[model samples]
Target: MSGIYIHIPFCKQACHYCNFHFSTSLRLKDEMINAICKEITLRKNYLANNILNSIYFGGGTPSLMNADDLSKIFETINKYFQWSPESEITLEANPDDVDNKKLKIFKTYGINRLSIGIQSFFDADLKWMNRAHNSKEALDSIKVAQGEGFSNISIDLIYGSPTTSDDMWKKNIELALESDVPHISSYCLTVEEKTALFHQIQHKKTTAPDLERANIQFDALIKSLTSAGFDHYEISNFAKKHHIAIHNTNYWKGQSYLGIGPSAHSYNGQSRSWNVANNKKYIDSINKEILPIETEFLTPSIRYNEYIMTGLRTMWGVNSDEISVLGDMYRVHFLSNIVKEIDSGLVHICDDQYVLTERGKYFADRIAMNLFFVN
Candidate 1:
């Protein structure tokens, strides 16, 4: 099965640490929606399978769009692709943008899942991140969404922020547990280049995230969440039984998906492509019936490395049999490289699947790099 990701490139305000393609202005909202629908039609045949297991509305903040905007896009998608009652339709929302009316509207559009961007539960942390929502809104949003019957909800939380003390971080996790969402995606604060947070750190205006502190918090997060019956399914994701994110899990499992809108990426098993990051350029191209995308065909070596990179970051781990399908040389390279990791207790084999140990989780990327099939 395949999936589609629709990018809504508009936000009410910019977060301090975000570098994703987005416009804070709503000047081109109507035009952008038209362009997105057009692009959806233009790339109808991109996914080999016409049946979609999932459709994700990601952002900038999908909740910023009105019901009419969502309806238009949904109509366009329905005209081109097919999804059933069991299919997962997700919308990424901000706390401030959520209300009973909006929640009902989203439910009417068949959005079975809501991934709320609740980065922190403290007012200080919210201000530090320049998020559009405050601490109270964060909790209220979850309560309201739950009240509206959005059981398959996930919340994004950021740890290791300069403004979040250990106590605050613990409180955040505790509050999240109390809120009782089925899935949680958490990440450590990283200052990406060209972001306000990076500039602040470079100018010594604010402190950078402390790695040691982050490590401790990560341990706390794992202990707290796992104890609460959440599976650490992916490196950055935890889910209750049967509640894993189908769209994102498909990505980790090397499934093909089509991404629409500015700065969106698509992979179709053999190659990868991404749309132009500029909203105006994307709209202009789609208006002219042209796809503003760059494509890169994946070499066997590249594909193998990608599998290794993504596979290791999940509970599914890398499969020896799958590696053999790439080529004998790749299998040889993997076998040779993995021995050292296995010997070091960083990885272990269970029925030929090289799964990471708890300690290895800390060095997931590094381990993947070490095991790469260098040409």
Candidate 2:
């Protein structure tokens, strides 16, 4: 089944570590929403008549949009596309946006899933990240969402920030578990080029992030979540049974999806496309009845690389049979090269597939890169 991803590229404030496309200005809010709705209709045929199984509201901060905005978008989707009664609808929100009133508004819409960005439950770390909410608000948001009867909820957390000690990291996980949320997405804090964090380290204004501490945090996360009976389905995601994010899973599995709004990407099996990242350009282009997107046709080598990269990161592993379907010379190259990896205890050979062991998961990208065809 296909999916839809709508990017709302605006935030109330910029975090020092963010490299995503967003503007702090709300002046363009109404114009942006109109552009997004126009985009939905403009790209309706991109899905190629596939029934949509998931609709994800992702962004600079989807929570920034009020209920009326969400209602109009949902209405447009229902009016234009084929949707299932049980389609998984998810909205990504920040903790500051999840009071009782807002949560009630969310429920009245068709949103069945809520992904709250609660980077950390410690005020010190929150301030370091320039988050809009404090520790109390983080917990309060979860309580209010739960109190409003939202069960399929997920919280995003960041680990290994300079401000997060090992004890504090454990506390953050414990706080999330204690909150009774069913899903959690924990990511290692990284310093991207041109980000404020990067500049700070370059200028010695702040200490560089500790890679060792980050690795330790990841190991601890695995141990703790496994003990808590959460399934480590993806590298950074843990969830109770039946609660893994459907939209993201579809992405990893290479299912077709249409992405609307600025800076969003779409894949329809054989080809991929992406809209312009500039907000004004996106709005102007769409207003002219032109879908401002670039297209790419995947070569076999590109598809193979993508498959290996995504497949080996999950518990499902990469199937040799699937690679074999790509044809013989390619299959021979893969099997022969994988021999060294298997000997190194980095990958295990199952009946007809190869999957990473725990240690291998840490070098997933490196391994996948090595397996890519050089031609």
Candidate 3:
């Protein structure tokens, strides 16, 4: 099953920790949309299969777009590709952008899933993150979407912020559970370089996220959500039965996908490509009927490492049979290195799959790196 990801590079305000490519001004919104449609037409045959199982509208904030903008894009998509009624269609939204009228418009456009950004349900945490929406809006957005009949919904929450104490973090999870969202994606606050949070940390204006505190909160998140009948499907994602995110699950499972718009990335098993991140350059190049993309063909070692990295972070785990297909040497290397992890109680073997233990999830990246087949 293949998927399509559309990046909308416009936002109303900048979050302190965001490093995504976007513009606060909507000056080029129309041109950007036109370029996106044209690019979709140009790359119509990029994916081998014309049938899409999922279509995700990710970004700077897809909810910022109106009905007309979405209509034009959907029209182009329908003109080229095919999807059944069961196809998962998701849109990333900010709480402030969701209202009764906007939700109705989104529903009219065939958006079945909503991934709302509700980082925290506290005014102080929202202020710290420089989020545009307040606590009330964050809570109300989900209710409003539910009221509008969006049952397959997900909400994002951030833990490990300095302003969020252990109690506050627990409260955030409790509030999210009370909202009855089928899925929740919670991430630890990281200070990426070039983001305002990084600058603040560098200048000693704010404290960096405490690793110990973050781990504690992660454990709490797992315990609370699991007790409430949510599956820890992915390290940072939890969902009730049959509610896992198909689009993101496809990505982790290394399925093919096509990406539309500037700064989007695509993968087709053998290679990966990403479009030029600059909005103006992307628009100009698309206007000239050129794809502003850079491609990289993956080597066996790189593919092996990538699989190990992504596979270990999920509940499904990594299959030894799949590793053996990469090459005999890769299988040997993985088996030899993974013994220590299993012996140390960080990983376990179950029916020819290597799955991370509860202790290992905290060090998933490091463990994956240890098992990497570096060239």
Candidate 4:
């Protein structure tokens, strides 16, 4: 099954640590929406006509879009592509954008899932991140959505920020559990280049994130969520059984997907492409009936490395047998290199498949890097 992703590139304000492509200005919002619809028609074959199992409205803050705007985009998708009745339609919303009124609009537009960006439940952490919503709004929105009958919900949480104490972090987790949402995506705060957080750390205006604290919180998240009966299906994601995000899981399984809009990426199994990051440029090109994007075909080594990187991050570990599908040499090399890790208890053999141990998960990036196909 394939998926479609539409990026809405406008946000109310920039977060201190966000490097995502978005404009705080809505000057080009209408034009961008029109262009994205046109792009969907122009690139309808990107997923090779696979039935769409998921349609994700992600971005600067998709919840900012009105019902009519969302419906117009959905109409374009329905017209140009095959759709499944059971398809999961998700919208990423900021806490400030979610209210009873907006949630009703979302239901009317066929948005079956809500991925709320509730970074933290504390006002201090919200201020530190520059999130537009306050603590009350954060708590209120989720309850509002639930009150409006939206059961399929996911919330994002941020940990490891300077303002986040372990006590406060536990409260955030407790808040999520109390909200009774079935899914969560938790991330650690990181300083990315060109972000305000980066500049602040570089100028010593704020201290850099403490890796130790981050690790501690991550461990806390796992323990707490697991105790709450959440499945650790993938790194950074926890869900109740049958509530895993189909779109992200399809991505991890290397399924094809079409992405429409500026800065959106599309993959059709063998190659990947991304639209131009400039909003105006993308709008102009699509208005002229052109797909403004760049693409790269994957080499075997690149694909192999990707498999290891993504595979090991999931509960489903990297399979040595799957490497043989690439070629015998890849399988041989991976098995030989992973032997040491297996012996060290960083990885374990489960039913003939190699999966990362819980301890190994903390070092997932380092382990994946070591296993990269460097040739």
Model 2: residues >4 Å from true position, as ranges? Answer: none
Q: Per-residue CA lDDT of candidate 3, range 1-375, in tens? A: 799999999999889999999989999999999999999999999899889999999999899999989999999999989998799999999999999999999989889999999999999999999999999999999999999999999999999999999999999999999999999999999889999999999999999999899989999999999999999989999999989999999999999999999999999999999999999999999999999999999999999999999999999999988999899999999999999999999999899889999888998999999999977
Question: Which ten-residue region of model 3 has the weakest summed lDDT?
Answer: 80-89
Cα lDDT over the full model 4 = 0.90
Better of 2 and 4 by lDDT: 4
Q: What's the alpha carbon RMSD for model 2?
A: 1.2
| Candidate 3 vs. true structure, TM-score | 0.99
> Runs in model 1 with CA error above 4 Å?
none
Off by over 4 Å in 3: none
TM-score of 1: 0.99
How accurate locally, in lDDT, is each candidate? 0.95, 0.88, 0.95, 0.90
Model 1: lDDT equals 0.95
Candidate 3: residue 285 lDDT (0-100): 99
Residue-level lDDT of model 4, residues 167-258, one tens digit each, is 99999999999999999999988889999999999999988899999999999999999999999988899999889999998888788898
* Candidate 2: clashing pairs of residues: none
What digit string (tens of lDDT, one per residue) describes model 1 on residues 1-375?
A: 999999999999989999999999999999999999999999999999999999999989999888899999999999989999799999999999999999999999999999999999999999999998899999999999999999999999999898889999999999999999999999999989999999999999999999999988999999999999999988899999999999999999999999999999999999999999999999999999999999999999999999999999998899989999989999999998999999999998998899999999999999999988777
Candidate 2 lDDT, tens digit per residue, 1-375?
Answer: 889999999998988898887888888889889889988987777787658899999989998889779888988888778776588889999888888878778778878899999999999999999888999989988898888888999999999899999999999989989998999999999899978889888999888789899999898898898799898888889999989989999888889999999999999879899999999999999999899999999877778788888888887888877877677767788888888888889999777668888888788888998899877
